[model samples]
Target: MHDESEVAVLRYGHRPGRDDRMTTHVGLTARALGADRVIFPDNASQSEETVEDITGRFGGQFAVERTAALDGTISEWEGVIVHLTMYGERIQDVEAEVRRAHRDEPVLVVVGGEKVPFEVYEAADWNVGVTNQPHSEVAGLAVFLDRLFEGRELEQEWPDADRRVLPQASGKRVVDADAFGDGDDPGGTDADGGANDVTE
Candidate 1:
């Protein structure tokens, strides 16, 4: 199995009103899609809190951290730095090479939230573009992660969740830990429905 922790995401240049929601989605997507952690280098506290809440409720080892010096952080990260941009090599063409090269090393995927500096482009070990067109950063990140994990992320089990959503064709059907049979209950709920409280 590919260790999701091998991949991390860095959201650079966060602006308050402008990039708030987008940056939050970037961090959430990174965690949900199988990244070890996310680094918000421009002080996205709200986003950090939301991600923390989600991880706390759902049970994940994923992490989120805020910092001010993104360039300096990237400079010190002991892994490959991949910047997602529109002006770089196509993701499909370079993903294979990237996987082979970083097979045994960690990967830090950089997603820009605002106008990026020229130094960022130079700092990256690989500048990858999902498409050479205007697109959502969230979409690019999801696609990149999907490619990197080769769809394994979709099958990942959330063992710590109090309530889990079952795959459905239409309507929503969430399975609380209390609903499962003894052997099936990963959360070890009792017959009295001793499941963890589903918080807001």
Candidate 2:
């Protein structure tokens, strides 16, 4: 359960695929990591569920708003603002907005997407290839929030590489025959380059 305090999270991606399952995942992950309130900045016309829906699913603990306005100081916010996608022509404006938000508060800006211009990269705190990579992204977000709230620099380096894929086991040899559940199991491949048929 999250505390009643507010944690601001700004998501800039507005396209359908951009805010698809990844956006929902981000919201759920933030709540699970202890964010009482999440402020999502939708800079496009694509709308997701309303704030009411978000609050209902999250126990009335989250807020979602759509706007292009970047006025006011973001230092008033208690948490970080992460950008899931980058803007096209208004890249400079986005950087300016993030800077304003970071001014007086410990902020964490995630730079994802392909159009990450040199300027934006120079301004961002951390950069990662895949924003939709849930596990690491969520954990990094949680760490950033904790560090920001604690008023300390992140004790580690910025996450700069793409999500690493683990090697899959070939499973060439069967360890136990009885472990297989009752089903039409596909037999292992034979050395003759053909499927081994399983017959009664």
Question: Candidate 1's residue-wise lDDT over 163-192, tens digit each?
Answer: 565554765445564564433434332212
Candidates' C-alpha lDDT: 0.78, 0.39
Question: 85-122 in candidate 2: lDDT tens per residue?
Answer: 32222332344444455555545344232233454444
Residue pairs of candidate 2 with colliding backbone atoms: 55-60
Per-prediction TM-score to the true structure, in the order listed: 0.86, 0.40
- Stretches of candidate 2 off by over 4 Å are 1-6, 41-47, 50-54, 69-114, 122-136, 146-200
**What TM-score does candidate 2 reach?**
0.40
Query: In candidate 2, where is summed lDDT lowest over 10 consecutive residues?
Result: 157-166
* Clash count for each candidate, listed in order shown: 0, 1
Top-scoring candidate (TM-score): 1
Q: How close is candidate 1 to the true structure, as a TM-score?
A: 0.86
